[model samples]
Structure formats: C-alpha cells, structure tokens
Target: MNRLLRTVFLTLVGLFIVAPLIVILVASVSTDEVLSGLPSGFTTRWLSDALANDQFQVGFAYSIRVAAIATAWAVVLGTSAAYAIHRFDVPGKSLLRAVFIAPLSLPRVVAGFCFFVLYASLVPAAYGTVGGVAFAHVLLLLPFVVSLVGAGLANLDPELEEAARDLGATPWQAFLRVTLPRIRVSMIIAAVFGFLTSFDEVDLSVFLMPADTTTLPVAIFLRLQQNQDPVTSAVSSLMIVGSLALTGLVALAARRAGLFATRKERM
Candidate 1:
C-alpha cells in the first residue's frame, strides 16, 4: 500500500512538472496563434520564425557568450574556494561557507536589485554592460559550483594527492594531476549548472542586460511583455531541447572519461 501510494504521488509530481513542457512543445508546432485551447494544426513555421528572428539570434549569441565566460570563472573560483575550505583549517570557516552560500537563499529579484544598487553607486558605467552582467551571473552561480565541487572534494581520498606529492610532484602538480582529475566530474557538473542557470536566469538578467546587448531570457521576457505567440513557445521549446542535449553530451563525456566507472562497478 505504501509503495503504491509513493508511486502514485511520484507519477502526479512528474505530470505536474512535465505538463507545461508538453503544452509548450505542442504549442511550438501549432499553426494557431491562440494557445489557450487545443492547437489547430501542426506546423514548424513557428520554430523557423523563432530561429530567423534577428533579436533572438543576437540575444542567443550574447547569452551563450556570457554563460560560457561566467561558467568558466565560477568553476575556477568555486573549485579553488571549495578545495581550500575542505582541505584546510581556516578561521571562520563556518561563517565563510554561510556567506558563500547566502545568495542561494536570497530572492533573485532582491539579489539583482542589490547588485544594481551597488553597481550604480560604485561603477555606474558597468551597470548594464556585458562584462558586468557576466560577473553578476558568476556570482549567482558560484554557490552551486562550490557546493557540488566541495561535496566531491569531501569524498576524495587525501592519500591520492599525498602519493602524487611523494612522487616528486610539486603541490600544484599534485593538485593538477591527482586531485583535479578525480574531481573532474564535479567540475563538469558545476559548469553545466552554471551555464544553464545563467542562460535561464530572467530576474537578474532583466536588470543587468544592456539596451544594446540583451540575453535570451531577458529578450524572451520583453517579448512576452509586448506580445504572446507561438513563437515564444517555439523559442522555449528550443531552449528545453538545447539544455537536454547539453546535459546528455556532458554525461556522455563523463562516462568516456571514466568518471562513472566506479559507480558502474559498484552497481
């Protein structure tokens, strides 16, 4: 009875999550402009139109660029911070961890507003620039990277790094050769998370996006504010498909890199 109830609950939850996606996917291919009711006919014109939109194209390119840069910075900085916190005894370590992860608890609007206020006061010129927006994205994503990579670091064996050092490797060499290789999966996961988070972030991006350089999510939001159509659904569907494809590619890469071999063995 308990197992049946659990299965039923999970099925409902899955349906709740996936129903909107199904609607969007269907609407993306619908010939009808009104998406409130059933779709009239199937067509790929909306998808084609979305792809051909110059604004969407520019926004997509900017989003990709910013997300890539932010992901790289977040991974590098978050990994270093996580490694230090996990491997060393630092004063105020607990406080530091709390500070690092505090953004996760804050509302996105509040975070964006705070950043806007700070930038407006300290660096008004950077308030709506691409670099500034990217930096904000990095800050927003850093906590996820730190948490994921820190978990991996916590699970790692210190002996592996020590053995590398004993083999005449310098501290940097030991970390690069031994520690990083073991945590590569976590790094990849963090990168994926950061990229996706930045790409889909609307609240912060809306505030930070410049007039000349908008991100995809901000563009989508602006479009929605102006008008709603099947084109919006098509764009959203493409984003969903893109995200899924990226995740699959990352998982395949991890498998090829032997990151999952131990788990497979245990299973």
Candidate 2:
C-alpha cells in the first residue's frame, strides 16, 4: 500500500512539474494571435521561423564551440586533480578540493558578475570574448568532474593498483591498466554534465559574452526584451524537448553502466 501510494504521489508531482512545459510545447505550435488562453489552432510556422533566425544560428555555433572547449579542458584538469587527490597526500589537499568544488555551491549570477568585474578591471580585452566565456565555463564545470571521478576512485580499492605496480607495472602503466578503466563511467558522466551545463548556461554568459554575438540562451533572452515573439516560445519548446531527450539518453547510459542496479544485483 505504501509503495503504491508513493508511486502515485511521485507521478502526480512529475505531472505538476511538467505542466508548464506542456503549456509551452502547445504554445509553440499554437496559431493564436493573443497567446492568452488555450491554443486556437495548430501550426509549425513558429518553429520554422525560430530555426531560420540568423542570430540564433550564430549563437548556436558559439554555444557549441564554447561548450566543446570548456568540457574538454574541465575533464582533463578535473580528472588529473581527482587522481592526485585520490593517490597521494599533499599540503592543503582539503583547500584545493574546496576551491574546485566551490563553484557548484556559489550562485551563477554572483560568480559571473565577479568574473566580469575582475576581467574588466584586469584584462579588458578578455572581458567579453569567447575565450573568456569558455574559461569561465571550464571553472564552473570542474566540480562535476572532481566529485564524480573522486567518488569513482573512492569506491575502488588501492590494492588493485598496488598489485599492478607489484607485477612489474610502472605508475603510469598501473593507472592505465587498472585505475583508469574502473573510473570511465564517472568520467563519461562528468563530461556529459559539463557539456550540457556549458551549452545551456545563460547567467554567466550574459555578463561575459561579446556585444556582437553570444550564446543561444542569452540571445533568446535579449530577443525577449524586444518583443514576446512566438519564435522565442518555439525555441523554448525545442530546448524543452532537447532537454528531455538528453536526459533520457543519460538515464539509458546510466542503466547500462549499472548505476541503477539493485543492491542484490550489485552483490
């Protein structure tokens, strides 16, 4: 009875949460002029218009470039730091970990504003450039890599790597042969999260992006300021659908990785 009740309650909550998304999805196809109430008729014109917008195209290209660069750098730096934190004892290890993980807790707007101020004061050229925005994204994504990969490392036994080392393997060989394989799932998860976060980030991009061109989310936001274009709704609907699809893919991947395994299955 309790399990059934819990399932019903969760279903209700999920539906409630997605109510706004459903409305937006409907609005994206609505032929209504006033956009006040329920959709009068269905059409795909808004979606096509949004897709054809030049600013959105430029913003998309920019988002992809920044997300790719940022995620790659964050994975490399964060994975190295995770390994170091797991393998050796060093001075200020706690502090180092804190610094990397701090961004996850800090509000994005505050962090973005701080970085913007620092850049404007110290390096004016970088204040509103693509490189600067990518750099900021890398910083924001570090915590996901560190936390996921560190958890993966912690679940591992040190004896496994030591055994490899004892069997005539060098340090690098032991890591590649034993440690790295075990943490690949964590690395993939981190990379996915880092990419998505960088791609969708708006608050930080708002302050750091160039005046001429910017990220897709920020572009959509600026356009909204001019008028409540139906195109924005269409763009939002696309984003909503994309988010759902990406989430489904991650869930499928996680299941294959045994993240959703039952305790009995794990045993």
Candidate 3:
C-alpha cells in the first residue's frame, strides 16, 4: 500500500512538472493562437519560420560561442580549484571554499545587476560585450564544476596517482595519465550543465547584451513583450528537443565507455 501510494504521488508530481512542456509542444504545431481551446489546425510552418529568423540565427551562433568559451574556462578553473582544496593544506580553507561557492547563493537578477553596475562604473566598454556575458556566466557556472568534480574526486582512490608517480612519472604526467581520466565523466557533466545554463540564461543576458546583440532567451522574452507569437512556441520546443537530444547523446557515450557500470558488474 505504501509503495503504491508513493508511486502515485511521484506520477502526479511528474505530470505537474511536465504539463507546461506538453502545452508548449502542442502550441508549437498549432496553426492559430493557442489562448482559447485547442489548436485550429496543425502546421509545421512556425518551426520553419523560427529557423529562418535572422535574429534567431545570430543569437543562436553567439550563444554557442559564449557558452563554449565560458564552459571551458569554468572546467579548467573549477577543476584546478577543487583539486587544490582536496589535496593541499591551504590556509583559511573553509573561507576559501565558501568564497568559491558564494555566487551560487546570489539571485541571478542580483548578480546581473551587480555586474551591470560594476561594468558601467569601472569598465563601461565591457558592459555589453560577448566577453562580459561569458565572464558573468563563468562566475555562475564555476561552483557547479567545482562541486561535481570535487564529488568525483572524493570517490576516486588517490593511490592511483601516487602509484603513477612512484613509477618515475612526473607530477604533471601522473595527473594527466591517472587523475584526469577518472574524472573525465564528471568534467563532461559539468561542461554540459554549464553550457545549458548559459544557453538558457535571460536575466543576466538582458543586462549584458549589447544593442546589436541578443541571446535566444532574451529574444523570446522580447517577442512575448511585443505580442504572443506561435513562432515563440516553435523556438522553445526546438530548444527543449535539442537539450534532450544532447543529454541523450552524452548518456549513450558514457554508457558505451562503461562509465555507468556497477561495482558488481565490474567485479
């Protein structure tokens, strides 16, 4: 009885969470405005129209570039920081860890506003540039990378690296040959999380996007502000599909590489 109740509860929760996505997916293929009742008819024109939009094309490309750069920076910095905190006896370690994860505590709007004010006052030129947006995203994403990689490192046997070092391998070589391969899955997960986070970000992008530039989320927001368009739904549905596809691909790759093997299976 308890197990049946739990299953029912979880099923309801899942439906609640997925209800909005289902609506959006239905709306994307709708021929008319979806405010009143069911769609008048089904059509694929909205999807094509969204894809052909020039602004969307530019925003998509820019978002890809920024997300890629920011994820790279976050992975490198976060992994090094996590490794250091795990391995070394640095002073004020507690405080240092708190500082690194502090950004995760801030509201995105507050963080964006702070960045905007700082850039506006100190380096105005950076206020609306791609580099500035990427930097802000890096700040937001660093904690995820650090925490995920740190968790993976916690599970890893430190003796592997030590054994490599004992075999006349240099410290760098030991890290490259031993430590990194073990944590590669964690890093990949971090990169995907960071990329998706940056790609869908709107609050921060709004403050940092230049007059001539915009991101997909910001574009969607602007479209809604002007009028309700079917194209918006089409674009959103595509993003959802793309994100799911990317995640599926990653899972497939990980499975193929035996990353998901249980201890019993390995034994």
Each prediction's TM-score against the native?
0.95, 0.89, 0.95
lDDT of 1 by residue, 145-246 (tens): 999999999999998888988889999999998899889889989999899999899998777757667998888889999899889999999999999999
Q: lDDT (CA) for every model shown? A: 0.90, 0.89, 0.89
Ranking by lDDT: 1, 2, 3
Model 3 residue 83 CA deviation (Å) reads 0.6
Candidate 2 structure quality by residue, lDDT tens digits, 1-267: 999999999999999999898888888899974478878899999999989999988998898899999999999999999999988997899998998899888999998999899898998888767788999998899999999999999999999999998999999999998998788888888988888899899988899977578999899989988988688999989887886798789879888878767669989
Question: Best candidate, lDDT-wise?
Answer: 1
What stretches of model 2 exceed 4 Å from their correct place?
Answer: 247-267
The CA lDDT at 64 in model 1 is 91
- lDDT by residue (18-91, candidate 3, tens digit) is 98998888898988866467778999999999999887888888888889888999999999998998877999
Measured by TM-score, the strongest candidate is 3
Q: For residue 21, give model 1's deviation from the true position in Å.
A: 1.0
